[model samples]
Target: MTLEAWAVAAVLYVFRTLVDDDIPLNAGCLEPLRIIVPEGSMLRPRYPAAVVAGNVETSQAITDALYGALGVMAASQGTMNNFTFGNARHQYYETIAGGSGAGVLRFGERGEALEGHDGADVVQTHMTNSRLTDPEVLEWRFPVLVESFEIRAGSGGAGRWRGGNGGRRRIRFLEPMTASIVSNRRRIAPHGLAGGAAGACGRNYVERANGERVELKPCDTVEMQPGDVFVIETPGGGGYGAP
Candidate 1:
């Protein structure tokens, strides 16, 4: 049901956006649109189906496809950067921010207008719309410390209009806990549009207490011992114009 709604919304949103037209909620704009999905398809899952995993990846992929078909922009970081960590008592989950694809123009993560072919930087895009939690609040509640959280500068693709930049987050566990990372764009880079360049792929790893570094898979849970730090470097959006 979630995907169904999202697809419908995407079509309406993209239809108006391509021509820089305003969207009206009245029947004049929506009356001609029709959405039909076959039973039990990926978009319309049967009851009792799990959607968390599908929701994150499929929605973003769908939106990217929508825009790609219109040739208006490039692809954004396709994952929600889902992060979750917990022990027997404490728990935390968040969808970290990343770059949005560069179009003829785009806004900053804060909604400010940016020049040329640059997309928004370190902002929430696509299906990963969520608030960025305050670091102090996290530290106050959890047994972990936020070592660093900032933009992975220059991580965006280079183009006539550059792709937006992704972000870097490092959290050190003060106690033993379990941490899981579930995301995409780790292997395949976000695609560019026109004569633009492809964005950088995302990366995740752990710096163990013993100074050893270990890479993590797309979907994996790891034991975080004391002094171990988990780092997430999200993917940037793809550039839309020639470099």
Candidate 2:
């Protein structure tokens, strides 16, 4: 769904002079997204599917595709999409995010955030721009508890123009259940532009609901039991200029 949206938007932007009025596109213009669910899949519901998982995953894909098509920027850290569900009164939750790429502009250039914070723009390519869901909604719909959610500090790459920061998500399960996550930017650092610095990588940790200690990677899908906790450290954007 996201890809189609972007494709259509791209066509419009390129042919604006001929089709629509030639309007200078400013930052924060959300790229359109489109999706087609295969028959008999989770998305192929009689009515509307939950859409939370689809939103998260599709967002990542759209971001990646945008980068690939535009070719004006470098590769991003990766996608940060997660999913969690509970059944039989059991609860499970997972949260994750991706990293940003190096600035591809001039040596002393700055990235466009489109929206959000400043610094390196949070390029949402074909593989990004997803949604896990709302904590309140998840807790009411599922059997999980959202411990905390915020942007991880000092995670962005260091440079003259620092990279954008990723996010952090924490979830605690009340009963034994299952959880899963799909993310990247661990192996491939976000590409940089000119002399810009690369962005930070992503990380994942497992803290027991009882406060135990356990660490994991950005990409992993596992089963969770009662009193289990999960923490997701999203990737950051790259620097645009030299420090």
Candidate 3:
């Protein structure tokens, strides 16, 4: 199992423990629990095989399962966890970042999709509410550089209850750097509720620091060298409640 799945499992155990005794007090607390996994998922690993999409896909499946079990809200826009690794001080340094899902409360009585998706927490579960201030730290430590990093203006889906904003991050490298992405919601738009619209899609791009560029899809893992930059646009949150 990947670290993300393991973390979820740990949280589940803790949540059960905390509410086991108090469950009878609140009927709402007695929802059933289930785990969702795509067939042949990495989470279903056997020592012999590995699935590259396991990390991000599994996390998303689990999140959807949580929402369904609770009978509380629609699925989240989706999760994004793009990773980058490079050599720094003769050692390897890595970083993972992504966007957040829409909130259930935002949807009115009739659930709807969000116009713009919001960013999510990092792997550590910190909500993607803010921005990363500097790429200099990563550059100083690793064989990478920051080309451009900013929020994608007007990328948010418009609706009665607008969706959250996703971010755009660009990274350049002095040497070849490895990248792995765990992102979704490109095919399925961020759902809305109570007369709202779906959110915009997430994307990744690889381009030269100077002129040419290439766009990468979700779950794309590649290598980059000097003068090449990787741009990651995070997903946004779904809109809530009708305007």
Top TM-score prediction, candidate number: 1
Cα error, residue 177 of model 1, in Å, equals 1.1
**Which candidate model has the greater TM-score, 1 or 3?**
1
Worst 10-residue lDDT window for candidate 1 reads: 18-27
Least well predicted 10-residue stretch by lDDT in candidate 2: 113-122
Q: What local distance difference test score does each model get?
A: 0.84, 0.55, 0.52
Taking all chains together, the TM-score of candidate 1 against the true structure is 0.84
Q: What does candidate 1's lDDT look like per residue over 1-243, in tens digits?
A: 587876676666566565455566554665676768677987778999877675677778778887877666788988898999999999899998888898855556874435545788889886678996799999999999999989989878888788999999999999999999998899999888877788888999999999999999977899999999999999999987778
From the highest TM-score down, the ranking of the candidates is: 1, 3, 2
Between 2 and 3, whose TM-score is larger?
Answer: 3
TM-score of each: 0.84, 0.59, 0.63
- lDDT per residue as tens, model 2, 75-151: 45556455555666655444445446543332223544322222433334443445566778887877667888776
Q: Write the per-residue lDDT of candidate 3 for residues 104-161, one digit (tens) a residue.
A: 4333455444233332322212222233445667667666667666655544444443
